[model samples]
Target chain A: MTLTTQQSKEAEIGKKANHLVLVVTNDTIDKVYPPMILATTGAASGMDVDIYFTFWGLKLLDKKGQTQTKIASVGNPALPMPNIMGMLPGMTAMATKMMKGKIKKYWPTIPEMMQQAKDMGVRFHACSPTMGLMGMTDKDLIPLTDSICGASTFLDWATDPNSVTIFT
Target chain B: MLGTSLATTDAKPAMVLDTKGLLCPAPVVKTSQAVKQIQVGDVLQVLATDPGSKPDLTSWSRMTGNELLSVTEDGGSPKVYTFLIRRMK
Candidate 1:
C-alpha cells in the first residue's frame, strides 16, 4: 500500500505517544486484579494499554483459571495483624481465600473482568515462551489474546514518550 | 473565673473529588484526572472509601509533587477517607 503525505503525517502524530503495561504474575486468585485494574484505568485515561501475560501470569489467560481466581489473605503482608500473630504459617493462603471471597462479593468474576477488558479494546498478549514452557497451545488461552509475543516486542511497544511501563 | 472563646474563619477556593463507592486505582485515577483540571494553588477535597487510598494518594502526591494538606475520616467509616490536596504546578 502507498501512503499519501497527509496520511503519513497523521500516522506519525498518532504514533507519537501511548501507554504500555507489562503484567507479570503467577499468584493464582489475586494475581489477575492488578493488571486488569491498571490496564482498564490506563485505557480510561486515554492511553494505550498492553498486557503481557507470561509464566505463571499466563494462568490468567486460561479459561478455567479465570473462573476460580481468588485473593490470598491469611498471611498477606498488606493485611493488618498483631506482631506476634503475623508470624503464623499458611496465613497467605488463608488471606488469599478471604480476599477472594471479598472480591467475589463485591465485583464481577475474573472471567467477566476479562470479557470487560476485551470489550474495552484492551490488547491482551500471551507470552510465547511461557506457553512453550508450560506446554500450552494457543487454543488453551482465552479468546481475547491478540497475539503471543516476546519481551523484545513488549519493549518496542513501550518505547514511546507517553508510554508508562507498569509491571503489575 | 470566667473564660471566653473566639472563632476564626479563613476563605479559600475548595474543589471536590467524589470517589466514594469506588475502589483502588479508580479513586487514585479519578483524583489524578481531577487534579489536572485545577489551577496551581487551588485546593481539592477528595472523598473515597478504598483502603488503599492512604498510601496511593500519599505516593501520588509525592510523585507528582503536589501538597497533601490532610487526610481525615468521613462520618466514622474506616474506609471513608477524605484528603485535602493543594495543586502544585
Candidate 2:
C-alpha cells in the first residue's frame, strides 16, 4: 500500500481504540472534580479509563480526605470575591458549602460518582511513592483503589498508541 | 446539527429516561446506563432539561457508535430536549 493509504489506515485504527488516562495531581475540590468527572463519563462512553492520583491528589483516596476537601477561595481568580475575603476564617467553609450545594443539585455527589466509576470498571491508581511520603497504608485508602503504583507503571499504561492521556 | 434519520424518526423506544433538573454529564451518564438495559437495535428515549445536553448527547451518541435517531426541543420555563438513541452494538 502507498504511504498515504497506510497513514489513513493507521488513523482509522486509532479512532476505533478507546482508552483514556487521567493524571490528577491536586487535592482541592475544584481540581478533584475534573478527573473524576472525566473518568466516570469516559467509562460510561465505553472507553477504558484509568485515573492516577499523586501528590496532593492522593489524599482523596482516603475517606477522611474525600470528606474534607475544601474549595480554594484564595488565589482563585475564577471566584468573584476579593482575595482578602477568602482569607477570612469562614470563607473557605462557606465557599465549599456553596459549591457543593450547586454541584449536588445537578450531579451526583463525589462519592456517588466514584462508586459509579468503580461499578463501570474505571481503574484507580494510587501513587506508591506518594503513599510512602504521606505514610499511608493500603488499608487507609478507599475501597475504590485498584492498585498502588509508581510513575513508570502509570506511564506504561498511557503509552498505548491509540489512548488519550490528560493531566488535571 | 445531526438531523433525525428518516427511517427511525417514528421508532418506538424500548425505554424512557428522565433527567430533568440534572445538568451536564449526569444526563449523558444516565442515558448511557439506560442504553445498556436494552437489546441492540432497540431505541432509548431520553428527556432532559439541561440545555447542554443537546450538544453533549450528540457527541456522546457519535462517540459510542449509538445512532441518534431524533432530537426534539420544546420551549418552556426550562427548555426540554428529547433524544431518541438506538443502540447499534
**Candidate number achieving the greatest DockQ relative to the actual structure:** 2
Kindly state the fnat score of candidate 2: 0.55
Worst window of 10 by summed lDDT in candidate 2 chain A: A1-10
Candidate 2: misplaced stretches above 4 Å? A1-17, B1-6
lDDT of 1 by residue, A1-168 (tens): 113533454455465445757676564665677777776655544567788888878878876665655454444556776545545777655666767677865555667767766665688889998889988898898888899999799878777676777775
Q: Estimate the TM-score for candidate 1.
A: 0.57
Using Cα atoms with residue i matched to residue i, what is each candidate's TM-score against the true structure?
Answer: 0.57, 0.89
Per-residue alpha-carbon lDDT of candidate 2 for residues B1-89, written as tens digits (9 for 90 to 100)? 12233354678999999999887678888898999999887889999998889998987876776777789999787988999898876
> For each candidate, what's the DockQ?
0.07, 0.35
List the candidate 1 regions with Cα displacement exceeding 4 Å.
A1-17, A70-94, B1-20, B25-89
lDDT of 1 by residue, B46-70 (tens): 9988888888887666545566767
The value of fnat for model 1 is: 0.13
